[model samples]
Target: MRLSIRSWVKRVTITGSILAISLVSIGCFYEQAARSRAIKDFPAPGKLVDIGGRQIHLNCQGRGTPLVVLEAGADTSGSALWQPVQEQVARFTRVCSYDRAGIMWSDPAKGQRNSHAIAEDLHKVLRAANEQPPYILAGASMGGPYVMTFTKYYRKEVAGMVLVDASHPDQTARLAQATGEPASNPIPMAFRALAAVAWTGLPRLVLPDAEVPELPSQTAKAITAYQPTSLAAAFAEAAVFEDSLREAGTFRTLGHLPLAVLSRGKPWSAFSEAERAAGGLTREQFNRAEAAWANMQAEEAGWSSNSTHQVLADSSHVMQLERPDAVIAAIRDVVVRATRANATP
Candidate 1:
């Protein structure tokens, strides 16, 4: 018993020491992140527009009849993240994309992050930037709802929509159900708890040296210059919006808008051994989740007077990024169809 007690004490001490070291390391990273973000020298591709009190980074490129707008996923990606598609499609139509509030160079706001609120902010940015009415809103993952809400709130302004692996409410329920096994575990509760702290505190250290890969080289450098402080601001704004998404019936209004959904053909749950070996599982898991989410969004889209679905059997959730040529062709086809259907008289 005495030996067991001694061993237990030693283990406790070791654990405590490891925890202390971890905390110190995190603190150091945060400091570096902050310092890196503070310097004011970086290049930006678009004009910086001031909306209310926030400075939003924006760019309008290409030229054509129908204006195309690309919206990104959650906190993990930004408008610049759609580089592959933009580079290709810009030749055919006017393509515009901007970082949402609290992302990259976009100024963080103290406003609510709900679908409606975000839609309103986007409208304000569009107007201020003079992008004008008649927008083809294309979104991936979480961005689907933002564009959907925009069309719902600003109907006349939206011409059509393209949802790339959109989110659905039922998926959340399915995920809850999936928690019965280790395979479908909803990110460990302990990890979530730790993540909450990291979200708030780590920004203090990481923003300084943090590197966002999605942004164009120049834009990334420009945005990274704002580090810790600006990054924290952006993170806070996202938290507010994420909280709103968690609320019941936050995006039900999307059902009444014109939309098209393109789902990935592959499912992570169905990944094979060869696929896992090829890194498909790592990239395919998120796409699989998004594909499931698209199905969830489909329910609401069906209720809408104007909505359609498309399955990209040969692509992943990141069809736009992974298969730019195919994505452009899909977008062009959708636009043509929407135009034809709308023009029928």
Candidate 2:
């Protein structure tokens, strides 16, 4: 039977649609595989806490008063970001760090991605895990705001706070503007999509330098195995909740609480002009100018009303990873203050 021109056109359209769908499906399949590989490569947390319907992966070591809870940044970072400082602090008091919902082994369950929601989830995690209250909350980069918002609403439960390169409202606004979004949108979904693609695909294609900081051998193997679920959840959370925290008034209720701000001091213009010629600021984009702006605003928050601000000049954004001594000192300082406050006449 001979086919009419109209029928041929329909046949071609259907074929194209099928091909497009197949490609997308294949891409997703590869993404899942890569994620599985990444997760299988990393280290597992010390324990798990069930909160808001999800099980959060966490590691806690040492024992002492004034419990310290460390929050990781937005990307795929977990407690691993504190590798530099973890052991050292573990010597002093009980130090706990965990992967947030949709990252690592933390199941993204039962909450929105807003700052307030994330903060509340942390609270629930602490309570469910039986972590004693009057605790000190410390978060770096995106985590800064997470803990700050937590303290804002759960002031009575908190003992103190440590904001390290936390996200500042003004800085977030600038980034949103730079990426062409209304300042109102906190987590820039468009930018996050691009970042997700880069983190997921580029590393495999480019093959990182062997000298690049690598996870420990066993840890690396575990992370690689757990890749699929971890990456998928992380990407999903970044797309939804990261910017969700930026919605106006999400953190309007900050209360007066003891706080410390650790600002990274890597200068943007310090990169050799030659390096600048290569690309964007190398020393510290997120932790330098942008982080400074955010930390400053956080300093203005009621929590920082009588706080100590420390500029970590020798460190990068990952102060915990790069300068554990400084991070430890900062945490210790806060612990001392809290101790003194409790003993006041």
**Which candidate has the top score in lDDT?**
2
Task: Give the TM-scores of the predictions, in the order they appear.
Answer: 0.68, 0.73
lDDT of 2: 0.66
Cα lDDT of model 1 by residue, 3-50, tens digit: 999999999999999998898777767656554454345434677788
Q: Whose TM-score is greatest here?
A: 2
Error of 2 at 306 (Å): 3.0
Against the reference, the lDDT scores of all candidates come to: 0.64, 0.66
Q: Tell me the tens digit of each residue's lDDT in model 2 across 104-208.
A: 567766545667667777888788888887788888877876776777687777787787776664565565444343445434565445446543453333433
Root mean square deviation (Cα) for candidate 2? 5.5
- Candidate 2 weakest lDDT stretch, 10 residues: 203-212
Decoy 2 TM-score against native: 0.73
User: In model 1, how large is the Cα lDDT of residue 252?
Assistant: 58
